[model samples]
Target: MLIAPWFTITVLAGIMIAALLAIQRSGQSRYDSLVTELEQTRVALAQTKATCEERSEKKELEITVINASLNREIAERMQTEAHAKKLRKQFELILNSAGEGILGLDTDGNFIFVNTAAALMVGYEPTELIGRSHHELIHHSKPDGSPLHTGECLIQQAYRDGVVHSSSTDVFWTKDGASFPVEYVSTPITENGDIRGAVVVFRDLSAFEP
Candidate 1:
């Protein structure tokens, strides 16, 4: 059998048209898949950025709290120091204004503080008596001109026993090697129920005598 020329041409055109349509449909499907994947990626990136911002905000808040606490502690310490200094000045003024001779000794019987009246009565400057052994400076001898032992001194006893002692016949030697009668009371200074030192208050008996 022989085919006609028109029929052969028609068959070739139909095959070409079908091939073109299949190619266009395949390209459209691929494009739709790519768009769906890109949308999913964008949503994941947005969630990650939000989580990072929240963590950064939380860390910043913690740092601010820590700084505030440190600042408060520093301010409280400064205030406490200032109050202590003011109290020390008040104590110094009171000691200078006292009429009786006052002496403060350390645990080792060394002079730690001597008021103005005490220094004047002993004929020495306040600076001269500080850090010196109290027994060596003025309490070395008795009223009868006998050598006094440290073990027998009442001031030393006060420091050891945490007691108060009073004497009306004791003598304290002056800086110029002279002696004067003194009536003194020695009392222990205590902290936390422990004896730390002694404080001596003395009056010149010569002033009371005619």
Candidate 2:
């Protein structure tokens, strides 16, 4: 009986060892399958990363183009403003430096602009003449001390015809209601065929009072 019991115990132990080995093999097979799936997942992730990088590159290129276009537009605007400033300065200089007295009037027969020489010739402060009518200030009279209403006043002619060549007039009025002889070259100011004002340049010739 003792030998038979020992033999049964030995067979049971061998069967248990065989079952453990089979379970270990199955576990190893499952681990191999898992490793293969993980590798496939890694490859898919790499492809996704590459696609994202390409899209990022495209976005960067578009941003670069937009920045360059904005910079060019800003540069052009700055250049235009600088050019306008230079032209305004030039006009001021030319008007002030002229030898002849220059007067600029608005379309409504009001004084709008003038140079330093013009004020000196008219014997009034330059600011006083602004917003004042030219006709009320500068009507011509004859040399015989009478109010001279000659042909057409230069200022009115300039406003009407929108142009004036050289016309020599020999009479004008002063601030103190004194009559004098003068010569004038007058014209209208225009831009694009639109009249902005009248301009008249005059010089007193009464000094030759022969």
lDDT of each: 0.70, 0.59
Query: Which stretches of candidate 1 lie above 4 Å from their native place?
Result: 1-82
For all predicted structures, in order, the TM-scores are 0.62, 0.52
Pull out the clashing pairs in model 1.
none
Off by over 4 Å in 2: 1-90, 140-151, 207-210
Instruction: Encode model 1's per-residue lDDT on 77-195: one tens digit a residue.
Output: 55654654565456556666766777777778988667788899999998999889999999999988899999989989988998878788899999998899988777776655766
Whole-model lDDT, model 1: 0.70
Candidate 2 residue 4 Cα shift, in angstroms, is 99
The Cα RMSD in angstroms, rounded to one decimal, for candidate 2 relative to the true structure is 44.1
